[model samples]
Target: MSDAAVPDLTELLADSPTNWGKWGPDDEVGSLNYLTAEQVLAGAAQIKKGKVFTLQRLIGDPKGDPVWPGRNPAVREMTLDESHWDEGNNGPAFPGGMHCADDTLTASLQGSTQYDALGHVWYDGKIWNGFDARTTIGGLSKASVAPIAERGDAGRAVLLDIARHRGKEYLEPYETFTHEDLVACAEAQGTPIRPRDILVVRTNHLQLFFEKGDKFYSDFCEAGLVYSPELVSWFQEMEIPNLVTDTIANEVTMDPHNGAALVLHSALMRNLGVAFTEICDLEKLATDCADDGTYSFFYVAAPLKISEATGSPVNPVAIK
Candidate 1:
């Protein structure tokens, strides 16, 4: 084909009918087969050429005085009931002690290093692909989220350092990042976005949260650091399949009127049939990879097999 007639990656994805018609009620969205184990291994090999950055926080007891005035589940103590164990002559006589862990867990929701499934968000009481938000988040299983599952291995991954692009490591309170800001960052980095590509936005929020403590969380919520609806529409039009960022929620900020925060979660996860990753520490990854280039990697994640849970804690890795 002539250069003018040749379709780019974004155009090809946008033009695919399978991509557009894959959403259905009876399907599994998050499954291991999304990207085969072999594919994941290959991506890891490529990433090994450089250092592999870990994005997960240590899942242990919370530390330090709660300085951030936000809901933090990680700060809650994990408790175990020894009564469940069988009493032995000297101690509990059982191969393994039976105990229940504390449930009051809170930590970073969107930005601490996690993946947002298609069922993660809801708009007007409806989830992405028209799944009932109340029913799906409360009862759906991985097998039930199949429409999302078939389109697995969301092709390619792109990282954008908005904070660095603007000449700072952190954004001030209420500093809204518009779609133009993202495009400009891509332009500055000389990397154009492609469809089915997983886009990671680095706000350095996690670094600020770790360094400044709880004040950063309070200020972040008060300041409204999120993407606009127009920006969400841009991703949908571009046919990008995934979005990730270091924030509490996918939306730029919480809406007080409807008690909805992170509207982008609704727009993308619920409306655009796109998956999202939250609480990701992309600063290191972006720095290691350098923002001027795109990386073809295999993304892997295993969510807890909890039926009907709103969301489960997951550990996701990007192998390039």
Candidate 2:
């Protein structure tokens, strides 16, 4: 679609609901507030067999890492190594002539498994909690990942294996699922959606990216939850605190109907104050869940406490 034909997010979400001031003006963590002590205990109660799974994808996978277009995978540069401590090299020597390896990594905060600040995306001139978008000028002055890191994320989480439900290794490009589809998938998996439950959805969509490499972005549409007023309302009613997904963007890359991209970022994250955890590696978690028929688990994660960051890399943990 031509840029002229695309509808502005402001127009698309003109009547969308917002949680502004709902948690008071100073609140930055948004719906995460739903993860109360009771929710944490309920999550712990679901742990069985003590199996653990880490949801962060390898940062520098040799085979290549998937990232949103216009972004690059993490690059690690060795700053100090055994090579630097060679006989003639001027490597810094410690008391015992000890040399330790060190490396520096450069990457986009949202380029890997990450948690987006509530103010990460917005329409008009406002962000989550009605903060001015200008607050993000140099770095986020409000609703940055710092607050989320301090509070932490630990609660009952349910995994919805949409690929398994559809009997496919992965959903095809541009495919979409709705809230109703989620309900049905939950029914099939025997995992009912509950209020304040953290949702971990797996489509294994990045399989294509790993397989096709640059070719994966030829058309560049992702299979994910498309936007709708009803879907937004469902999230609000369910009081979802976090949405973790194995996709570049948690929601469809572009709304098929209106051509507006990432409407849910505004509808869910910005407006409803729902936290978004994207680019997760859920293969192990989904496989374990499928084998054991236990899709819900105790989930926890805390992003790096980078000041004023829009997002932060996170390795979320799911325990069963």
Best by lDDT: 2
TM-score, one value per model: 0.67, 0.98
> Which candidate leads in TM-score?
2
- For candidate 1, the lDDT comes to 0.52
List where candidate 2 sits over 4 angstroms from the true fold: none
lDDT for 73 (candidate 1): 49
Candidate 2, residues 1-320: lDDT per residue as tens digits?
88899988888889998888989999999999999999999999999889999999999999998989999889999999999878898899799878899999999999999999987988899999999999999999999999999999999999999999999999889999998999899989999999999999999988999889899999899999999899999999999999999999998898889888888999999999999999999998899999989999999999999999999999999999
What's the lDDT for residue 9 in model 2?
85
Residue-wise C-alpha lDDT for candidate 1, range 167-249, written one tens digit per residue: 98776555667667777887877766654456677776555556666566653563233544466567666766566666555
In model 1, which runs have C-alpha deviations exceeding 4 angstroms?
Answer: 1-22, 25-50, 61-72, 75-89, 92-112, 133-154, 217-229, 254-260, 291-298
The Cα local distance difference test for each model comes to 0.52, 0.93
